[model samples]
Every structure is written in C-alpha cells, then in structure tokens.
Target: MATASTIFSDCSSSTTARLVPLSRIRNGILQFRQSVSVGWKPKNPSLNFISTHGRSSSSIVTVAMATEPSATVIDGKSVAKKIRDEIRSEISRMKDATGIVPGLAVILVGDRKDSATYVRNKKRACEAVGITSYEVHLPENSTEEEVLNSISGFNDDPSVHGILVQLPLPPHMNEETILNEVSIKKDVDGFHPLNIGRLAMRGREPLFVPCTPKGCIELLHRYGIEIKGKRAVVIGRSNIVGMPAALLLQREDATITIVHSRTKHPEEITSQADIIISAVGQPNMVRGSWIKPGAVIIDVGINPIEDAQSPRGYRLVGDVCYEEACKVASAITPVPGGVGPMTIAMLLSNTLVSAKRAHNFE
Candidate 1:
C-alpha cells in the first residue's frame, strides 16, 4: 500500500506540495480503508489531481503539467455499472431476507419523444437493478389535477418506494404543484421544494438528492478529486441541473459561481475555476479558452446536432468543445458516455436508498 505522502510526492508538482493538506491525506486513508473493508483492492493507489492554471489564486502551470500524467479520466459509466451491481446484490439480499422487492413509479405526461425515451431508460435501469418499475403515461391535454392525482396514488401505494415525474410536463400543467404532490419520502427525483431547501442549507439531510448532480459528485469522489476550498464554476442555472449542481458543489466546500445566459463575460469567470461543470444544453458553447488550463471539466450538456455521416442523422454533443477541451483540460468527460448513463444509475441508487430507509434494511 502506498502512503499518502508517497502518493503526493510522486507527482513533481510544486503547487500540490503547498496545497495538499493533511485533511486530504486523511480522506485518502478513509477511501483506502473503505476499499479494504469492502473486500475490494484499490485499483489505482496513486492520488489523482485536478489541476488549474493561469488563475489569480496560484501561478503553477509547471505543476499542472507534472501532475497531468498522474490524473486518471473519471470513468463514470464504469463506476455507475459497479454501483448498479452493488445495488442488485443488495436488493437480492433484501428480497431473500424480507420477501420484498423495491419498486419505483415513474409518471410521464405528454407525448414528447425525448421524454418517452428517458422514461423507458429509467424503467430498464430499474429492472437491471432488480427494482420493479411502474409507469403512468398521460396525454398532452391532461390537467394538473390529473397529474397530482396520479402522484397521490403512488404516494399511497406501499410497494412504490420511489416516485419520479418525467420533466417538461405540458405547458398547461403546474410543474411545481405536480412535483410537490408526490410525498417527500417517495420523491426520488428530489425536485420537491423541501428536498432542495434541505440541500441548500447546511447540516440538513435531504431525503434524496437530484440524480444528475449526485452522479457528478460521485464521479469526483470515486476519482479522488479535491473539492474543498477550490473554485468551481457551474455554467447554466436550470432548476433541474445547473442550479442543483452548484448547490451540491458548494456542500463539498468548493467556492461556487453560477454562470447563466444573462451573465456577462461567462468565459472570464469560468476560466478561473479549478473545477468546471457545464450544463447549459448548448453544443460547444463553452470553448477551450474558457477553461483554466488543466482544470477538471464535467460536461453535462446532451445536445444533438446535425451529422450526415451517421444513421441517426445527428450526433450528441456537450456544452464544452470536446476536441479543444481535451487538449487544454487536464481531464474531460465525453458526451453520451459521460453524464447521461450516470444519471440513471444514480436514480436506481437513490431508489434503493429509499427502500432501505423505508424498510429499515440497513
């Protein structure tokens, strides 16, 4: 086993020499201890650093390059698979012990193709994790009351441990009212005002966290990225993604700045962040220059743009310019394979968590 000092000393980085704290070393110890306890050997014992350069906080481009080779690409898809497998094993154990299988209920209102696809994927993910999935589909003309009634029914259903209402509900329906109608205990999507409020306030535990943001942080943790006291910039402020992402990042002690469409000089602000998470839904909106050289880039955008060579007639893209970002950023996530799959994995994990809490399985 590699000692914490050995892990940090192997990297010839002067910035890391100063910034690496005993607390971070202690965290590495905890992670190693958890791996040992779980009967899993550490895959890569060397510490991975998310580097930032050309920033006012530190002048350390040399260290950034020295540490770049030591950093590993955070494989969210693989990590999500491991998480799902763990959940499946746990679910199997619970079923054998208590004769109960966790169930998740998803509500989809309207006929949007993308929404339908997301719902199908969620159902498939639930099944893969041994969780039963129940879905309700409604027409575009459905009233807000109808949606609320469906949620109320799920809330009362003893078998349904988690409830998720597909987003982009018809313009006529009140999204907030429909979402709030789902009992907080079953609010697996974690969009309820109560959950969001708890997440924003310190020392309050949320019943569940929104899936996408939770996955982002999970990537950081699994890959050993240091978030405490680092500058993090979230580009975009959608209630579903960007806003929640910023809040979650802040919880990890990262000084967070939100860059929205209306914000002037978005790049200028983003360029200063040690960690950059972009969820703006615009293809290649965040240029390479916007990133501080060697910063960790988490691209959350899933935009489909024209591509004649493909059979699908288009290709998926992220908010960051991938080709340029890969060269400038120390580490960057690829579109489609990055944040998309992790979102569903987190949903299943949260459902399992809800079931365990409801049944006292843990």
Candidate 2:
C-alpha cells in the first residue's frame, strides 16, 4: 500500500507521468469508481489524469488557504490606494492641458457624528487627489430652502464638478427635495431620483452610479472575477446600496436576486448564489452554511456593535459572519478595511469622471 505522502512525493519526482498527487488522485479515483459503480464510463479521462499542480492552480489554492492568504481577503484598502493615485495623475494632467481643477462641493447639515466623519473623509480624499473641496456646514435646524439654495449655487458654479449632500438631514428638512435640487451632472452621490431610475432601467446609462455599490463592482473588476451568467444574491433592498448593487449586477448580465427583510428562507436562496452581496444592517445575518463553496462575498454592512474592550466602545461589523464564512467562502471582504475605503475612492472617481465629461476632456 503506497502511503499518501509517499505517493505524492513519488508523483512529484516524475516528469513524463504527469503525476497526479494523492490529494487529487484520491478525488479522481473516487469520481472514476463512482461513475463505474453507477454503470457509467468515465467520459473525461484526460481531466481526471491531469495534475492539478500548475501555477494557476497553486495561485488559486494559495489564495484560498485558511491561514496563508487569510481566506481570500479582498484588499479594498490597497485597491483604493491605487485608484486614488490614478485619479491624482489624471488631475495633474488635466490641470496641465486644460488648466482646470475639478471641484467637489459637499453639503453637510446637522451634527450627526457619522455624517460629519464621512464628510471629513471626502474632503481629505479630494485634497489627496488634487481636487478642490468646497464644504458647506449648516446647523441642525437649517431650513430645507437653505439646503436647496446651496445645491443651486453649486449647480450654477462652472468649476464645481460634483455635489454631495451628506445624508441624514434634519427631521424637519425634506431629504428628497435637497437631493433632487442637485443638477444631474453634479450629483456625484447619485442619489438624485433621475440617476437612480436610469440605473434601474435597461439599455440606459446612468450619469453616475452610487459610490458604495460602484466601489463593490470596481473591486470585482479589479480582481478579474467573473460575473456574467453567474447567480448573484443581493441581500437588502435599500435604494442606496442594495438596489443599485442588484441593478449593476444585472447590467453585467448576472442573474440577480434581491433579498429584503420580508424575504423568507433567505439562507435557502442565498446558498445557491455564486456571489453574495449582503448589505442588510443585521450583524451576522449570514452564516457559513448559507454560502456556497467557492462563492465570492461582498459584505456592505457596517453596523456598529457594542464592545467594552474597544477604545470607542463600539466596533464595526458586517452582515456576514467573518470567522465562519472564511472557512466556506472562496473570497470575502472584511468590514472596516474592505468596503469602507473603497466608497471614498469611488466618490473621487465619479467626481473626476463628471469633471472630464463636463469639460469634454476625453
């Protein structure tokens, strides 16, 4: 009886044998015997005998390793860094050629800490990319007309290429009114109803895609992940992330299924997906068993959970259970370091794209 290690070592030493190591040889033999046991001939002998030890196979296995690649950690931080650098170069070139600097105007109302933080980050990203940042801060009791007027000013300003109204406006102010007032061309956040509607419809191109969802799709593209003809499940139906995500996936020719709070047996449906984008705010809503083997997971949730051990007394969490999902999933995005940075990057990208289109830089 050839021990498994001995067989693998011997196979590794062979040149002409096209040695199939025991790890794969066991699977191949089992598949062959199973076919024979069912009164069927193994129709794919070449596939069965081929050694799965090539560079591509090794690269994939290396990425999928439990402790080595850390369960296919999607490095959104690094990806965002690259994108920012590209944007910086583009801005420098645009300035040299056309002598115009793209400008982004952000309107922040009220004192919501989260919204403030997001606005600050957006400004910092603009500064890094050589884009001018115009920020308008209003009190919590600011009138709806005041917010709308700010948007109106940015709309007429030829230098301003992008306008983003920080979300969660005051209770008295109308959110839709403020967002709709932004000119479609300057609506970098893509919250305007017209952009959202265009994004949802087929055969139409949206002037801008919402930042977070666009970031997720950019991640998939950067990684060379296949999406066409694949089954993708987007958990959540919010207009911001989930709905736009599903629309984008559909645009890529993926068969998309949108799951919401009312959805029953969500896991049963999710288990069939080749790709899962969970944006539901519930922490750990998705488990290991809910994911298909070799499935790609994009976790868009950023719920804050209480933790006494942390300095902030709260920590960010995603909808999927990171620990368990790592075991079953082929690739996954971590909570804080993953989708968060990409959102800002995509916003900058959309701003630059808007500026180029406005100036006909292309």
Candidate 3:
C-alpha cells in the first residue's frame, strides 16, 4: 500500500505544487475541509488556503500544499471607474467645445427582472458620464413590429448617437430582424450581423464592439498583459462573448482555439493556454487543475447558484473557480466585480465613440 505522499508525488514534485481532490487520494482514508478567510487579500508572500479539520474520517490524509500565489488580481471595478472618469472628462470637453453631448437610446421589451435591472443600470451609467439616455419600455406581449418601430425612430434621430436593444428579447420576436433595424453606425451593442462580420474580417473594423468582450480585452490591455504571440483559448462559442472574444484575441495576434461542450480533454487543452477567457455560464466549471501555472484568466461567466446562507437565496459565481485559479494563474478577474462593471463601462465607451463620429468631434 502506497502512502498518500508516495501516491501524489508523481502528480507533483517537491519543487512543484498542484491542486488535487483530497477525496481522490484514498477512497476510504481521508476527509478534510478547506476554508479561506473571506475578503483575504492575496498580497501575502505565501500561498494560503487554510484547512481546519480536527478529526480525519479516513485512515490516511494528505493536504495539497502550494507555494505563495503570486497571481495579480485583475481589478476590473477599479479600471472601470478610471475609464468612466476619462469618459466623463471627454464628454465635458466635447460638450463645452461643440455644445454636443452623446446620447444613447435603449429599447427594452418584457419584464424579466434581470433584463430590467440591466437596462436601469445602463441608463444610470449613461447619466453618470453626462450622456443623455432615452428608453422605451414595452410590455412583454409587445409585437416585433412595435420593437422595430422604436429602433427605426432612434435610427433617424440625430440626437441619438448610440442604440442598444436589451437582450434576451421575447422568444417570439425575431432577434436578427430586430437587431438589423438599428443603423450600423448607431448599433452600440454591436450585435448586428454587419458589425460582427466586420469584426471577423482582417482589414475591416466594426463601428462598435460588443461591450462585454471589448471590456475583457480592455482589462488585459490596461494590466499590461501582452497578447501577441500567446496561445489563447476561449471556452465557449456563443455569439456574444465567446465568439467575439476569440475574434478580438485573434485581432491582437494571439493564436486562438475554441473549446465547447464537445471538446475532449478540456483540462489538457486549457493547461497549454497562455491566456484563457471562459464565458460558459457554468458555475465553477474550471478548476485549478485546468489552469496553466502563470497563465492569465479572464472569467466572463456570471452564473447564480442557490445559497441558503444568503438573503437573496442565491449568490453569483464565475465559470472559473476563483479559489483554485488564484493559486495557479498569473492574473484573474473576480465575478460581479470583474467583467460585470466593464461591460457597462464599455457600453458607455461605445456610445461616446459613436457620438464623436456622428458629430465629427476630435
């Protein structure tokens, strides 16, 4: 019978450390509980994941030891604040110089709580940056033609420089048709087929990039992460975040591979990536073992899971397991505070850009 140390020695050596499931070492031998202090900053010189278990339920127990986690936390919330300030300053200067202020129009249908909250937030963000926001809220039973009419109205309004159609529209509505109605120049959400097509081309540029994916790349750039010549993996293929993220990464000259539900041996593929952007809406799907040591991780998923301890009966989590990835990756983004804020900030950015182009403002 091999000891737990002997069994896992082959998995990692004394010089190298890797996280493994404690239950896998010996089926009936050990039971351990791991806990880390909430809001514990990772600036300490040592990798710290505290274990507090008085008694072992199994015959033998082994702990996963690791060196100091040096991963830089990609602070999206702070970066977003900086971006908003910059946008605010630019808007003031533009307004002063040309007496022109950027304006964003949003057409929202249905009454989904999440969608309503998102629309409200966008309106608030627009107001914060001195951008005028116009909204049309329709009942859930509204027809596609009605939504299209609103978009058409915005398209012709010179005062409205950016147009966004809140997503997850009623199932009966034709998303493609509705998205296409917004003039390409004012399509700030960047979901139009023409915008996506332009983004995919080498020599062409879309008037606006999707907010969430654009924010992911922006976070990387602000952090001084080099994307050129890197091996990148996008862990989803949805048109919104994953696909656009891959295209954006490609535009930055990084070699790209997409892993979807059908991909075999995801861990093996992910381990080789220098940069990984996960947008698969699965809670804690990517573990420590799936990460490459020193790789940069941009987690775009915001999945809610039931949590009895919470007042809301649920809590938000990202696709990448934050605790596990923090130990292995060189840098990572936290959910809620990570890609979430950036999305709205980028939306504001797109609106400002559209306003600048529309007014021929420098």
Best by lDDT: 3
Clashes found in each candidate (C-alpha, N, C closer than 3 A): 0, 0, 3
TM-score of each: 0.79, 0.81, 0.83
For this target, which candidate reaches the highest TM-score against the unseen true structure?
3
> Residues 174-235, candidate 1, lDDT per residue (tens digit)?
77788889899998888888999999999998999888888888888877788999999987
Identify the runs in model 3 with alpha carbons over 4 angstroms from their true place. 1-66
User: Model 1: how far is 11 from its true place, Å?
Assistant: 32
lDDT of 2 by residue, 1-362 (tens): 11001001111101122211221211001111111111112133321222322223444433434232225778788899999999999999999999999999999998977678878888999999999999999999888988988999999999999998887677898777778899999988887888988998987889999988999999888878899999999987777888899999999999999977667667777889999998765555576657777788998876555445569765655666665566567788877677878988989999999999999996
Steric clash pairs (candidate 2): none
Better of 1 and 3 by TM-score: 3
lDDT per prediction? 0.72, 0.74, 0.77
- Write candidate 3's Cα lDDT for 1-362 as tens digits: 11111111111111122222221211001111222111212332233232211222223223333334546778889999999999999999999999999999989999977678888998999999999999999999999999999999999999999998887788999988999899999999888888899999999999999988999999999999999999999987777888899999999999999987667667778878999998876556666667778999998876655555569765666767675577678898877678888998999999999999999999
Better of 2 and 3 by TM-score: 3
Better of 1 and 2 by TM-score: 2
Q: Which stretches in model 1 have alpha-carbon errors above 4 Å?
A: 1-72
The regions of model 2 sitting more than 4 angstroms off are 1-70
Give candidate 2's whole-model lDDT: 0.74
